[model samples]
Target: MADDPSDQDGALSRRRLLASSAAAGGAVWLLRGLVRPGSAHAAPGAPPGLPAGLDVYQRAYENWAGEIRTDELWTCAPRTPQEVLDVVNWAYGAGWTVRAQGRRHGWAPLTVADGTPAATRVILLDTTAYLTAMTVDGQAADGSATVRVQTGASLESLLAFAGAGGYGVTAAPAPGDLSVGGALAVGAHGTAVPAVGETPSPGHGYGSLSNLVTELTAVVWDGGAGRYVLRTVGRAEPDCDALLTHLGRSLVTEAVLRVGADVNLRCRSYLDVPAAELFAAPGAPAGTRTLAGFVDGTGRAEAIWFAFTDKPWLKTWAVTPDRPLAARAVSGPYNYPFSDSLPEPVARLAGDLVSGAWASAPLFGQVQYLLAKVALTGDITDVLLSGTLVQDVLTGDVLTHLLLDGLRSDLWGASRNLLEYVRPTTLRETANGYAVLVRRADLQWVVSRFADFYRTLLAQYAARSEYPVNGQVEIRVTGLEDPSVCGVPGARPPLLSALRPRPDRPDVDTAVWIDILSLPATPALPRFYRDVEQFLLGLDGERATVRVEWSKGWAYTDTAAWSDQDVLTGAIPDSHRAGGGPGWDEAVAVLGRLDPHHVLSSPFLDALLS
Candidate 1:
């Protein structure tokens, strides 16, 4: 919305000085190409063929769960497109691989790893340092809005930019810290759909943020130029589909996303619904508060069922033009105060568990459940208004509160604000995530079966004196990013996006995302995750297709995430094939052609792309 080239120049100059100072002062790593103005190289041990005057330094990186960490390596923060292009070309020529580093709020090892030779001769392309420019690129003929953004820009910045420009995404991941480049690369998403009595917005699709991309500009090999150059790919091009969700096989510098008019959203939470009733069998009594029942009532719903507990925290968001009766109006995000900041009691329990009180894991789990219960009930006034209405509007058991209490669940804000509900610093835990795509009719059945399986597995683990999980099982539902909704000529859904709809199952438009969170220290998490992974993957293909969420943990084995040999070699490849379609092959081929030298790669990516 505003232009300031001078400000950009100043910022770049300051970063250059920092890089130069670090290099001159015996910096551990150097930006191979970015030498100080008076120096030939940034550091004495500078690698060959690096361009001078680049912003490079030594930096350590960590993934969200702290499961993925990379030793301090030579990292570059390119502020402009030319800078990125130069870095890629230099890396290609020097035989060094480059990986884009966003917020690293992920569990996968697509970018960097903890150990092994793969971490050698690798450099992190830190996008967040300088490439965060965003501009509204005018409206299309169909009245759809378009905004061009630097890939390194965080979702929070993008949302702020969009809100300022009078445009916004239909849904976004709860954590605002995710970088635009990372989210698009991994198909990050949020829970959203057309409400029961609402009409779908124009130029909006209920899919991952990757679906919002109308065009993306990336640094790719250019034979004509004999160097990597910035190339803008339109959504209609087949290569665009592959780039939409590149899985770190390629690098994107910027993207043009199609967005719609901003809207107000009201999100409410309820925790009295017993897991048994909510996840009951599909044919259970009509009055039961089933997961599907919540979805049918309002398209947006999330259920967080804590381990070793009966009640689940149910959050439902609906598009509301104005505040509903007895609902507390929220001004900003992170409305779940207790969740945003751990309560003292819970923190103490967590500390003790971390301090070698391994056997206290079960007790820790109970404490967490009790904390949530106390926080939810004690602070009802903080998130809701008039406890009498909560009591009077419901009928039958405590579960009835779900029906009437959802509207009064204490937070009302704009879609963007409400979507940014996750705190930047919160519980750090390893999580296994999956997206189960099924038709609306099968939502109840799928949820029930999965919940039953999870419950039984936890019981079995407990029987063996193994408290594998101490956190909650979070479940959310969202519509797939239907390409047709974008209304772009020749637009096709991202080939690799989990939200991509299947051609054979036209009726299967919704995706149910489930997450099981627990600390990495959990004694039996890997085995527990393995069983869950198998159950999800073994679901009836005709009824539901399970796919790993790109940024979240998956491919569970007894020892690690993304290390299940069968999943990596079989299930993953097959799931992307989408019932023997050529899309997967086509996407891989296009990506290969774009980066013939594989300049943009890591060991994990190399294995997957190979």
Candidate 2:
């Protein structure tokens, strides 16, 4: 414990709080049960003393979107696995739910939520302090080396660690700032669908980061021992699916991931594809620069179409051993300084929009497109002329084909550096995200439907003089992680991964993720999101299976997020149960058994698992 007077005062206040709560409610047994075992009160289930080498503090937590805020009474920085175990045991004994806090970069309420009961005692385990140990544990049977790391390690650190040894992941979240534990907890994934000319790589899984884990160490309850202990679970275990994507119901200490040899990558950027042709209706024609066509040309692709802009900045990545013609090489992440750091004009427009100029969103969006075009390509004159030509002379399809010639290229260090391009210091906004799993053949169908829906909704909002969306609509595709990638026989896909193939549609192997981001302050943002959510949710079990992105936003009601009863309690559970095996229920049951007392649960998790 620190020698600071505030620490003493906080401790005194906590003690007094418990005493007063019990006394005010006339609950004598509550006070008796909460009293410290060896203290003057000598209660039975009181929290044990802080273990040595652990620093406890009072801290307030806020989710990435600033939608949820929580102030935990007891928080600690655990330096080692033993420290994590000690904190878990103490919290369990004291009947306090234990939540591991990393970067808190996720939008979901998996850790702590706005609705968590104020009276519920909670303890946050801060993992980044000292739990970021990384070690190469020799090679695995799958040809890739086994790298064991504490879950608290940031993705950037882990990627750098692997890159130092000439190893890398197949795909990862764009933001390098995310912690490995946090990323895996929500099944974080990136856009990397195998191209037509691509070949599967050994020791690499295109699925969520959770899919890369060969083994993990978690602080689970040991009923026989009557205390929390670290248990190493392997990928082959039946309960491993649930653990891989715990959805914030469990605490993982460390994980051993399988990584393959690193490869140089070429990331090409283009901003000429017109929205109508790029997101054309399914099976419109044979030759078109559609999103699916781009994915077919290159295994990796991302489309960032500004709200009301016809042209979207399309980025595609390809594996390359050497530099290509007319390309530059980038050494680290955040390669797009123009996109990550909003330009002066864009910032001003965004500021105005956020400052109650909701009507200016359309104009704000156009200015954003202009800035991105000028900054990325260094030639705004041609782009401006081209946009005018697109609207005036060429039709949608003809204009799109003409614009496809604007592809630019650059080489990046490795998969890790190239894949992580987004920076936290960049734009901040609320987003609704989802995954639409369909067969590769059905890619056109799903994407077209989404694009059409989005376009139609934007038009409707415009007709009503409402510009709710202020950010781009992002689109990406990735191959579902086949169990074979784990090199384990009879291995199952992560039960909670959105990329998991539905039992009814075993042929599905591709997941098209879509997201719409906007400032929370935008007028009618919630209503717009709700409309979009309903449309996506309706796609479930029809053309494609719709699943919420665990780390992003979903379960949207007309007024707020995570508020839709049917979607939360029905649609989401049904999506997890798509395969018909012991699905969400079984996973929840297993997690519940592992923590029988629910010592690792929160109000949000309880509802999600309910």
Weakest ten-residue segment in model 1 by summed lDDT: 23-32
Q: Where's the lowest-lDDT run of ten residues in candidate 2?
A: 25-34
Off by over 4 Å in 1: 1-44, 116-119, 140-143, 379-408
TM-score of 2: 0.87
lDDT of 1: 0.75
Off by over 4 Å in 2: 1-48, 115-120, 140-143, 382-409
lDDT values, one for every candidate: 0.75, 0.75
lDDT of 2 by residue, 1-610 (tens): 2232324534322223222322232111111122223455332333456566667655556555555554333567887889888877877777678889898888888888864533458878889888899999777554577789998899999999999988888788898888889988988998887788677667776788788888888878898899988999888986787888998788998998888878888888788888888888876678778988888888889999988888888889888888776777677877766556553434545555655678877765776675556555655464446554223322344224333434223545677868988776566667889998888888878878888899899999999999999888999898886777766677777777777777766788889899998865567888899898888878847668788988888887777888888999999998888767656888888888888878888877887797
